[model samples]
Target: MPDGGPVIVGISRSTEKIREIVRKVADVDLNVLISGESGVGKELVARSLHYFSSRKKRPFIKVNCAALPGELIETELFGYEKGAFTGADKQKMGKFEAAADGSIFLDEIGEIPMSMQAKLLQVLQDQKFPRIGGHKEIDARARVIAATNRNLEAEILSGNFREDLYFRINTISIVVPPLRERPEDVEPLVYYFLDRLSKEHRLPKPDISPRLMKLLKGYHWPGNVRELENYLKRLLVLGESKELEAELEAAGDGWNSETDTASSQEAVIEEAAKEVLPNKNSREKQFPSLKEVRDKAVYRVERALIKQVLEETNWNRREAAKILKISYRALLYKLKDMNLTPH
Candidate 1:
């Protein structure tokens, strides 16, 4: 198999086919569209295309269309001259300019606003676009590779996405199968994550018994490889084989076992919460307001979840966004808001 790229890992036939397509498409400059469910590793395939292409030595830029605010989308893609906007104090190079003579991966392409679609199409059609506040046109020498989890056909029918832009970027399309559809790759992926994550965290790798591996393969991973990777990370963090054993038993016997484990999990959570939040008795006579308490709790959980997901994906925000089922832009905002920097 072509192996897609260093980041792509799987032994399934479906995976092999995707890798082959990526290898073939990488050699060409045609705009390529990658279609897959969120967390199915569309960006990895995009990276693979860039990694194997002739432009490998050049910059490989990525822009998440869904993450860019509607008002800023144009300026973000095309450079803006000084005084173009309130914050445009100086001329800034956009993603396209930065990606000159290389490849640009536009993720969540379906979420691009309709108003910006025509401008994007213009660039694709003419390979030239003017800066936000400049009269001169700048040539876009970068090859475009776009990926989306949405059904563009449906978006076109609903008039949400432009058919012209779709055709422009869809010169070649590659669809990555979801994890459930590629069961044969599950075991290999499990071990891969185990080894990588173990080395990453400087922890001992845990052994997965055949029965546990079977249980893992049988489960429907709605979140795809990302979800599997997160699960492995959780296991490593908890340092408990019994947790997976309990989960597998629950899967086999249904809700009864889960109900039994829920209490123990809840106790652990409560203890952790208490450590983070001061005890009521230990607080001063005046208690904190309800809103303050709620806000603190929310902040703690949100920060923790974001940090955990980031660790699992090795700080790949795009994959973390897919697993969290949020826009890539939103994830960035949260990281900023929560001040949760990757360690």
Candidate 2:
């Protein structure tokens, strides 16, 4: 049977191609890898797959790999016998077992440790996984849909991820388009969030002047849908015109954090610069040969600096934007572009 789900908000060859693939894959028990940058709604695609699949009525369990400690993820997923470890006073059913006849969604799958990747691989290949401290292999028949924002191929190359596990989970891959790639969806999303946020905040629905709509579409959404949704929710609460203006600047792909006249541009910039280009050596340090390593390291310093500056400025995005010497709108764009949280 074809997917009877609602048509996704926007329509285009790209989105249609995705729909086409889902229609084909919905009935199969393949291990699917849903890939995209942060906030691109990979989880939406996963839910759609489960709803349209043969097991629609079964459980849809979500496991956020990044939300747990690396030491405990395996037991969390594969279960353990009574007394498996320090806290295992009783036998436990892990995520895989809990969703036995349904589907399991593993979000941020790339965050799984290298050692555990092999266990996941065995489960995918053989349809079986043993309890952490138990003797017998249990029937692990649930369909697996895993999502990740990181490039696992890069992780594999860096030896931080397993190649075999990548091949296993990536048996079928679906890449969700970023918000910037689908401008047609913006208006609908704004309307959707505005109304819902208004209701949630117990406020009157906002009248987004046509001018504001234009400004929003003109900006690039680096944080994807989540950023847009969050911004609109804040608007319903604050009801400040500046929130709308700040969102416009954010859409412009800038990293401005200044929210008022009192914001100190010089102070924000000096702190931001130091945070991003930290004196790792306080002298000279030999750089790595791999571009990914270098990029990851640069991103490391950049993220740390951004986080610190945002904290110091109390998340006054407009002022932070001014400090960065970019339009407040531009700063919003860059923060999203960097897939980073703003200060």
Total residue pair clashes for candidate 2: 31
- Please, what are the lDDT tens digits per residue for candidate 2 over residues 241-332? 86678657664644333323124544555555555454676677654457655676566655555555667788888877666677888767
Which consecutive 10 residues in model 1 have the weakest lDDT in total? Answer: 252-261
Q: Among these predicted structures, which one has the highest lDDT?
A: 1
TM-score for each of the candidates = 0.71, 0.69
**Model 1 TM-score (2 dp):** 0.71
Q: Worst ten-residue run, lDDT, model 2?
A: 254-263
lDDT of each: 0.85, 0.79
Tens digits of per-residue lDDT for model 1, 1-343: 2344466778989899988898788989999999999899998888889899999889999998888887778888998999987888999899999999999999999988898898899888999888898888898999999999999999999999999999999999999988978989998888888888998899998778788888888776768888889989988887767867677566656644565457654654575466556667864755667787678777776676778779879999999999999999999999998888876
